[model samples]
Target: MVDPDDVQFIDEMPHTATGKIQKTALRDMFADYAFPA
Candidate 1:
C-alpha cells in the first residue's frame, strides 16, 4: 500500500518504444511502499 497524499503524480511516464515505463519504472521499482495513513 502507499499513502494517497504521498503518491506523486507525473504528467508523463517515461518509457521506451515498447510502451514500457523506463525511467519512471525505476522510481517505482525501488520505491518504498507503505500503507495509507
Candidate 2:
C-alpha cells in the first residue's frame, strides 16, 4: 500500500497535440517527489 500523504494528484494527465500521453512532462512534474526515509 502507498501512503496518501506521499501521493501527488493531478487534475488530468498531460497530453500532446497528437493526443499522446506526455511521459516526459509527467516525469518532470514528479521529479521532486520525496520518498519516506
Candidate 3:
C-alpha cells in the first residue's frame, strides 16, 4: 500500500488540449509540493 503522507488531493487536474493529462504541467504546478508529516 502507498503511504498516506505520500498522497495528495486537488480540486482539479491539469490536462492537455486533447484532455490527456499534462504531466509536464502537473510537474510544474506541483514543483513545490511537500508531503505531510
lDDT for each candidate structure: 0.72, 0.89, 0.83
TM-score of each prediction: 0.43, 0.66, 0.63
Give a tens-digit lDDT track for model 3, residues 1-37. Answer: 8656576678899888899998898899889997766
Task: Say which candidate scores most in TM-score.
Answer: 2
lDDT of 1 by residue, 1-37 (tens): 8645666567777889998879778677648866467
Runs with alpha carbons beyond 4 Å of true place in candidate 2: 1-7
State which candidate has the highest lDDT.
Answer: 2
Task: State candidate 3's TM-score.
Answer: 0.63
lDDT for position 16 in model 3:
83
Once superposed on the true structure, which residue ranges of model 1 sit more than 4 Å away at CA?
A: 1-5, 23-37
Q: Sorted by TM-score, highest first, which candidate order results?
A: 2, 3, 1
Q: Residues 1-37, candidate 2, lDDT per residue (tens digit)? A: 9646666679999999999999999999988888777
